[model samples]
Target chain A: MPQKNTLIYSNWWKYAGAALVLYSLIGGLLFVNPNNLLFLDETVRNLNYHVPMWFAMISLLCISVANSIMYLKTFNPKFDIIASKSAEVAVFFGIMGLATGSFWAKFSWGTWWTTDYKLNGAAIGELIYFAYLILRNSVEEQNKKARLSAVYSIFAFPLFIVFIIVLPKLASNSMHPGSGDTVGFNKYPLNNNLRMTFYPAILGWIAISWWITTLLIRIENLKSIENTDEN
Target chain B: MLLGLVSHNMFAQTTENPFYSNGKIYVVVAVISIIFTGIIIFLIRIDRKLKKTEKEINKKNQHKD
Candidate 1:
């Protein structure tokens, strides 16, 4: 029943760990052919990990936001915990995405921080997500916390879309691929051979990270359920 | 994507592109982060519901006891 299912989440690490190992091996094979890898200079290899992670992270956030809305609608405490837990997993991935991306940027853009539209927009997003976490902590009332957080989460999603998507298009031109007037957005063309590796990298990261984020939500839900029943 | 093959290009030992900076790195990173954050916010609600059910169960048990 619920108890039996709870065990599944507790042991999620096994699945996540195994997936990581598999991805690493796959990455290794792609890395073996450095010359033909995407980005041409071995720099695009970061996309395998970085790009997928960003997708996984956002996917996790999307789920979390949905859960938050449910909490507000149903006034359910369990929803809030699941939402919080998912955010934790999301944050973990997000930070990694940022780090790996910044590392790539240093090589691709000449500096860690750039004065371009896309970079600035991203920094703002990082701050907003960070603020989302902080805002959650600042509140104590269960009812109030759930309501306020839900409101904030909903508001934030659109802002993210605007900053990450819309604004970049309307702003200044950037050397950062497909940002401004770069016909077809920043879809950096990956070589066919490299695409073989890079595309899978995206798939692998998303599959693995999505599983972990789901596992985290399940764990928090179960643990909180146990705590309440015991009391 | 700019390798800056110009004369003053950064002295990259190999014919590697010296001008290629991680400019779009932030956008990619932000997109990743935004997605993750969205997921967590959703999960929080699920956790709260589970807690509610647990609470109801406990109340029933207390009355029975």
Candidate 2:
């Protein structure tokens, strides 16, 4: 048996949020607001929040896919619950990311919607996740629903990567900087302030997403138990 | 600009610009976000407690049966 940790129920993310706010204030006072810090461009200011959302969404999708694959291997309904709830959280964050990204674009690029590679790729990825929900719902049989959802979620992993990866390379026009240009990912400039805040924001968002997903899964499991008893 | 000089040519509507200089909008947004998180947390707790209660009820019924 695995050792039960008391820390599991601890509200760690609340403390993490406090630390993040404190760091943001200190960083602003010391490194950012001082020395006339113009390192991060005005538009890139939103990147601290928005970019991390995309990263977190992708990470949640990955967990959903992994749980799906596990369900396929073990033929377990428990794994299906994990997969479904994770997918639900992923889709929620994915849509929110898209909405916030559009807001950013509106402020920075003078348009609410654009054909930029990142924007378009994200739209398609949202559609793919939406399809997973639609597919699971349209089916009737309990076992077939679980089995088919598992199989479909497995395919989403590769399809998501392919759709997102291909857009940046395509000759299609994009308003995003370095869209058509073949600049190496590492060599592309990210200012020091952005580097520090961006990575931690992604980590924080990932933790928060997992927290939300876990809550949803427990609720779903409770509902299932109720259903079984009633039947 | 989406926001521009308002003219009397258009009928005056205070609620139309609810996001004016008033801090009310910000406070409302903050409250909503907090409430949303609180609701999710509350739902999870309720679900857990209900499940436990349901189990106990079922157990009592089973013993009677």
Candidate 3:
């Protein structure tokens, strides 16, 4: 279990997050979308669902990378456990983002997959993280595994950002909004009603993602503590 | 208000696309349902993890006894 004073041990935020998520679902569906984009009419509501996955992923991965840095500085096994578990949750969110994006593309772009820079970049970025997990598993010695994985995570975070955010913008064409020529939802697509749900949705999803990561970390702690006791 | 009128007009208008069917409201339902299902699946995973941990703890306690 996390320290009693820690956010992970606190129950209020988890309940708040659940309430916000439920509100977002109902309000997201009910909110009026004023923008009448050609292909993305009613599906504009997907903004509340799809975009938040990436936001949650990025937030959790930021935590993961921060913990990795902490581990490198202190060589603490606890930090390494936190780093790995958060990364695992972040990858789960990234996969959700990819799956939802693919489904959205099928309707709007008229294809399940496309040659677009952002889409390919997102996929490749996930593959890099997958390699990070594989890298963690291949090494056996506890400290060595933690040290190596932390270093890999530190190096990979920048590359992941470049692949998902930077490369998409640098490329001449991208189907995704806020990249290439297409303006973000803030410019025109999102009106006040949509914003009411959108911001809360992102916050809520990120909160839930962190909650899940903390749970995983607790489980890891329990198992590792048991191992130490037996040894 | 003007915003109300615009939204009413928005809902009044309909298109032939599948997304626009039932004033495109069902699309929102579908998206919400998918997300709900995903959350439920995550809950199930957490439950399984808790169960495994409980079993481990029980085994350790038995050994101590």
Q: What's the TM-score of each model vs. the native? A: 0.66, 0.69, 0.81
In model 3, how large is the Cα lDDT of residue A166? 95
Summarize candidate 1's per-residue lDDT along A104-175 as a digit string, tens digits.
888876788777776677667667778888998899876787788888888887787677657887876865
Q: What's the lDDT of the predicted structure labeled candidate 2?
A: 0.64
Clashing pairs in 3: none
Candidate 2 chain B, run of 10 with poorest lDDT: B2-11
Can you tell me the CAPRI class of model 1?
Answer: incorrect
Tell the DockQ for candidate 1. Answer: 0.04
Candidate 2 residue lDDT tens string, A1-231 = 112223223466744743463343233222221112233244454555666677778888888898899898998676788888888888888888888888977876788998777678778888998999999999999789999999998888788876665666574666654455644323544332455555566776776677677666755655666666678
TM-score of chain B of each: 0.61, 0.47, 0.64
RMSD of each predicted structure? 11.0, 10.2, 4.6
A185: Cα error in model 3, Å: 1.3
